[model samples]
Target: MAAITYKCPNCDGGLVFDPSSQKYHCEYCLSDFTQEELESLSQELVHRKAEHQEPGLREQERREQDRREQERREPGGAGAQPVLYTCPSCGAQIVTDETTAATFCYYCHNPVVLAGRLEGQFRPDYVIPFQIDRQKAEEIFSQWIGRKKYVPETFYNKKQIESMSGVYFPYWLYSCRVDGELDAQGTRLRTWDTAGMRYTETTVYDVKRQGTMEVDHVARNGLRKANRQLVDSVLPYRMNEKENFSMGYLSGFLAENRDMEKEQFVLDVQTEVRQFALQSLQDQAGSYSSMQVRKKEAGIRDEKWSYALLPVWTLTYNDKARGKIYYFALNGQTGKICGKLPVDRKKIIILFFSVFLPLFLLLMTGGYFLG
Candidate 1:
């Protein structure tokens, strides 16, 4: 397929898709067109209307017809351009009409992506482009693996470590305002004296509490198989750096749409929201010698949700003796790293006996001798 380029109607300068506004904007003349207009023109040339027409094909036929009709309104019918690509190697989806000289697969770590297949099957809203390039990622990975004394030496070598990728993991970000109210019993202890004897008394009081908090950008994992715990451990991404979505920045990297829907993540989000509400409500209770929450009610409201692709780098290594896999995760955006590694049982046992045992014996000998 030829490299396609969209030209502006007013000035004929090159036009590019603007993800922030979801419009095609011409950088030269500043003319803007909706994505529908741009797509209709590009699809017109390839569409020949599927071979067999069925009886109940009315709905599909109508939508197709409407799109075709809009194509006629486009300025250039025959010369419209395409702006997306698909990776044949790993099924990575991308959008960049310009040649991506080099590309890597996020899932399979393949270096090949056929240029022809990237004809607009998948698109992304925004991309947090690779701030830490491949070399930087390797450096970070090595420093991380070095701290693991029991990690196999082979795992940190160049050949094995190059497989590390700067992948944009998918996620769903939800922003909402929360309001909650809770009631519980609070207790306090007091001492009383009667004649020569003293007795202890317990006092209980009714405690009522209410609180409100606004949360911005609570993220839920969009990849079902992804370990949320691992993702969270590397968190505190610089959310302010996030850009509005666009396919252009995905030119040489790998990304995927959120296969998991917003509804599927509600249960997980509710769990976090409840914990946040509980903490805020507890703070409002001021000072209580001890408090037991017997009954609780909390709620979430004014929620805004959207699918997002966040960045992460994962490294997995095998431990021979235990025959279990250990993994480490790095937050691609903020560079925070966290994960589990192999621990040497022999070293642990030796250290315990060599250090702690002698210290314990010395303490006992001193107590016996000095007593």
Candidate 2:
């Protein structure tokens, strides 16, 4: 309903969260405040407004709250339409899609969000801020493409490169401890030669192994609509560095709400933990030519899942003729990269014919002439 800006208490300037400093920065006054300090200050503002405002103003605010809640719960609450606002820093008009919770201003480059977009299911419990910046990401991309020369000239066009945006992906991070047991029949083969006679003997043993193992930081993407495989490929953020959720970390980046809940990933998390525990005990099963595992149980005693935002650099490009969209992902913290790259059908065909044609001709001539 209104443009809300995080204001600096000292200078009343628009405050932006800086990634390097992990603090809120005032663009106009250059004041810096710890994230906790600014949060406390925000709480103070809300309390002062409620206490000092007139009764008529309070009534209006209450009515507005009711109206907003009704719109969200009613049919076709809010969809498709992007929120429009002017940047408090440079007065640039900005528009963001409905699902977008956080993004940067194009003109002034300040991060903006419709505070409503980050409530309830859309809110993140923790966030891993971007450690890799644009220049380093570009260098990584360049190194990746420099080795492959035939990956369509249009892939690296200025527009597609510029579209490489830092995005916070929603993930369900799980930690669990499983007490597991494994049962299997293990076999050992023995061979002996004596007096020109060969003899073979097989020894079999029933093995039972049990142990407790803990798995931490098992991640699954929470957005059903996004490419799950692509998201999984980027994997493995440094979960140890995760910090409490705050809008300051999301500044100057693109972010979205989690479309799926922790419930969706529960089975997957349990399954992974089970497999890990089984393998852990299986490693202690001694030596065998082959062992077929029979019963394996994780007995997953405990599990915890938290909604987290992991950072990634996302580059998406389309092959219009092939009608396919390709993605390149760079780990925002570690700079590890992965993606699908298009293959040139023409080059493959040429190489195939070059290697196979001469051999086919030689075989044909040898068959006819030698016959």
Candidate 3:
């Protein structure tokens, strides 16, 4: 198999996959390809005999042909037509198929995100947009520290807080249908006395449950740095709000496509999907004292996928004293917060002396008086 490289249809320059638009785009010629065109072109090259050309040359041709075919079938591909934007400061380039309000520069991390970029290929089906902006995110972080008794004074002050940033993390959203079958043996204990003697008895019942669950959208983080639990705690995002992918929405945000492909997570995700489906079944089970799930099986059905951007605010802090890094995450959509905190050993010592000393002294005085 030859490696493929897409070239611009217009100018014959290199092309690459544009996640925001879900298309192959040419930076030089500014042309787009749909999924159909991309697929068809991809297929033709695979079977078609190549002339006596170098492997590199043949690979490049296949890539360009694939991009054109992709644009034909993919709705988010070039056919919808997006406007491209370039940043003068960092030379970061972006394109949006629809109108967007803001855009950011991927190269220099500029936040000049335009307001109109959310309507097109950059648009998110649903946005857990930046409800906790940088400033507010700092405040929330400081408050989180304040809750910790005996935290170092340095940890609470504005100097440290100012270093915090609200970063928008990228993630993938998946939708699937789930069917679950679970079997277990439930045990009920009974006690009875034979005459005056005590007797214990137990009864076991075979339990079985089968159900269907429709999972609308399950999200998995695309960035390696994004903490899975912290990101998940902020759920559930309003998945219903997701719009088709448009490049415009990406204009102003720090966005990334899934670093890990969709198939990589299917097994891990199956558990969550089954849990959701089983919740309904357990509710239906009603009045069981305790249910033990024994044998269980889940099958994902009617699976369909779309790439989307969810929202999160992440901050990383280095603790010099502890020689470790601490992270804080906030749910961009729900404002829920979860993260690790630095514990000060000095403060713990102070707390112990303050509380335990007085208690010990009082105990000693009472003993002396009583004696």
Best by TM-score: 2
Per-residue lDDT of candidate 3, residues 1-371 (tens digit):
11123334467554444434645666666788765665566456546745446789877866755564456347577634655666544566665433233444456544444333222333355544444455667767778867788656665577766655444455667788778887877777777888699886777777888877777777877555456777676777776655454332333345443334567777777777776677766666545456787777777889875556765666666788679877677766566887877777887888788999889999999999999
Report clash pairs, candidate 2.
none
lDDT of 2 by residue, 222-292 (tens): 77667877777888777788899876666667887665668877887788778777887898999999898
lDDT of 1 by residue, 85-121 (tens): 4544445564432223224444544343332322232
TM-score against truth, every candidate: 0.59, 0.79, 0.59
Best by lDDT: 2
Give model 1's TM-score versus the native structure: 0.59
TM-score of 3: 0.59
lDDT of 1 at 45: 35
**Runs with alpha carbons beyond 4 Å of true place in candidate 1:** 1-127, 190-206, 227-232, 292-295, 318-324, 343-371
User: How far off is residue 261 in model 2, in Å?
Assistant: 1.4
Q: CA lDDT of each candidate?
A: 0.62, 0.77, 0.60
lDDT of 1 at 216: 76
Candidate 2: list runs displaced more than 4 Å. 1-95, 106-109, 292-294, 343-371
